[model samples]
Target: MNNAVTLKGRTEGFQIILHASASFEEVVDQLKELTVQLKKDTQKGHELIFFVDTGNRLLSADEKKQISDIIEDEHFKISSYESDVISIEDAQKRAREARPKLEVRTVRSGQILEADGDLLLIGQVHPGGTVRATGSIFVIGELKGIAHAGFEGNENAIVLANFKYNAQVRIGGNVHVIENRDENLVQSEDIQFVYVNDLHIIEVGSLHYLKTIRPEIGKHSGGLF
Candidate 1:
């Protein structure tokens, strides 16, 4: 019997699902096309997510190389996967175990907070304020400064905010600075989160799932700024 591989795209990046009976070359070609399409869409102001299924086998050397090339070129972010194919239940358990838990309020200047779990900022993260985490960072108010997620080297971590006015942002060491903050900024009521998928750090809507499932108690009552 042949192996089957499935590729799926999400709001932040892509994943691969492997079944049985598929050619590695074909999968790589399809991924290339998907990357091109994603790039074009992003250029046009459209956001997308991606995923893949690798039934159960580890990626081939050549296939890994192709994926590495795409990631190096900044095509799209990569999320996560099992080192080996596991049962769906096992995968879910792994995901739950991998998620982080974090909390904060009133990020002041000259202060830095780092955590292995998701971070929640109830207020603004002021200029010169820095927060780093291995999971996702959520800000209920404005983000007027810098925030880094996936700090412990977990590329799957995310950073989220209600209003993005940050001078800089770093997710998994990928830095993005707002050169003209006065001109280019995102002002919206919606929550935003950044995560790494497919080797890229991408922003996406809300962290409702994380928040609901892994609620963190507030440690500091002050504002983050």
Candidate 2:
């Protein structure tokens, strides 16, 4: 297969490295074979997540999907993609999306709101409502509905909301249901950050220490984090 694909274990997790300067078809073929071998070695009913690292190669969205299609299996999931190259045009677009957006209206029942990057919502998210962002979510009002961050597979994204009411938070592919109803948990007192942990489970931590947890979150995001 010309070493088109190499699977390696990283300190953070496992990654499937795609060789640069190789034919796309060759890479695809190797990916398929590697995934099959991975499945054979995996325990029954077990799942594995892999980050695709395309060294010196910038892949189009369709090409990314093609790789995903090859590695997809009952036990295999493509967590995210790492590319060493990006066109100037794409970089500019990403720069624009990196800015946090603001929403002032309340999210009513059955309403769904989405943002390409970080979202700074100034209104409440009621039950039966939903909010999703490719980055993080910073709500100025009560978040009683569902909030999903890193909806596009960036696990580092987070959701900031009061934990005094019931809600659902999703970070990447991990989900956590919040049922806290204690009145003591008010804004500024019980605001929590929801995110996917190292264990790939959705978890929450106190906002008081958010700086220690994700200090860099304010970078290029307009401090919305």
Candidate 3:
């Protein structure tokens, strides 16, 4: 009964936590109040996607629909309530393993760099070097080697590089080999990235269009990137 429904904002989005002991009716009422407050907040441009968490409770389909109906409105969308947050210890371990940064001068042939989370490289990948990650991979320098992102089956992960040559890039299970091109075809500082499109094919494009195609990665929602 205490704090039956709680709403918390995160950098990526918001989280709505429902207490396990609360009755369905109570939860629905709290959701209504939350949405009303959210409406007011939206007027100030404080809009964000939100995920629901039914702590220690498995909601029935009808109950879920009812909850969704209560929260269905502009500026508020329900992501899901099925997955629970990981334990603090597990989170810490993930944070350590997926520290999000790995800087090296140059990745030589046979050299490999991998990450469980986003990987940021400040140097170049030589012709035979390799980089693999479960999340997005960002290379600030030239990339002429192999780059594989979404290694853990995340189709949304992307591979970005400041200078592109003939590199083998893979996003999820899709792969694309950038053929050697005339250097004059692109600007000296041109940046490019590879990703999986709606048709499930790997495509190469400019970084400027990344946000347009994959907003979730830009926003870091659901640890998507």
Candidate 4:
């Protein structure tokens, strides 16, 4: 009998269990092989589930990068099958309520701000300034400090900024740091915020709702003419 990868779908999330006999290297090899197969047969659709044993520590950065690449590739869409899953309607409602509205300017040292909708920063957030929100964060200037989105446990929050030289970023508690600055994220006035699969924070293109939410910015109260 040929050993096959097993995937279990549950209400909460999905679980993938690799056969006990499969080694880490073998699993990786199989993933590559599957990638090829998926490419060959576009209609079949590529599906995979990765089960990580508690005893095994996932420490290989390269392997992780490869796996991430595979999952993020345009050709594949991975879904989680788990026991306790939230319905689509419930998820959307939660996302809207949990989405915060953040507005700030030059978050100084030792300042902590939290929002339940979206975050809009008019100026820079200095180092040591901490801001967290449940929805999205928009910084008009640079983000050279610590910021977190989805702090209330919602992962759909995004962080957008005019510049991306942040010291640290946490999306749903998943932290990312700027080890080095590049042109794509340096001195660029154009920045945006979005969530990855409603799971992680990402840079996107404009948060249009800000105008509607903050009507005072462009509102013209008419005087007796």
* Best-matching candidate per TM-score: 2
Clashes of each: 52, 0, 0, 25
Q: Model 1 segments beyond 4 Å from truth?
A: 1-104, 179-186, 197-225
- Candidate 4: segments with Cα more than 4 A from true spot: 1-102, 181-189, 197-225
Give the Å error, residue 31, model 2.
26
Ranking by TM-score: 2, 3, 1, 4
Q: TM-score each candidate.
A: 0.43, 0.56, 0.55, 0.41
Residue 184 error for model 1, in Å? 6.0
- Span of 10 residues, lowest total lDDT, candidate 3: 216-225
In model 3, where do residues sit more than 4 Å from their true spots?
A: 1-89, 96-99, 181-189, 221-225
lDDT of 3 by residue, 1-225 (tens): 477998887776888888888887788888898788778767655556778888877777898888888886655677767545555676764775445667767889999988787888889889999998888999988898998898888998888885446778888888887766765545345777778888999877787798898886645444412
Candidate 4 vs. true structure, TM-score: 0.41
Between the candidate structures 1 and 4, which one is better when assessed by lDDT? 1
| Residue 61 error, candidate 3, Å | 26
With candidate 2 superimposed using the best TM-score fit, by how many Å does residue 34's alpha carbon deviate from the native? 32
Each model's C-alpha lDDT?
0.60, 0.84, 0.79, 0.57
lDDT, candidate 2, at 31: 81
Which scores better on lDDT, 3 or 4? 3
Instruction: Write the residue-wise lDDT of candidate 4 on 1-225 in tens digits.
Output: 344344456554334444445666666666666656646765555444433321232325585565556544554544432223445675665565443354646788899877655666677778899878775566777787877877876665566664446467777767767533564544434564444443344434354753443333323233211
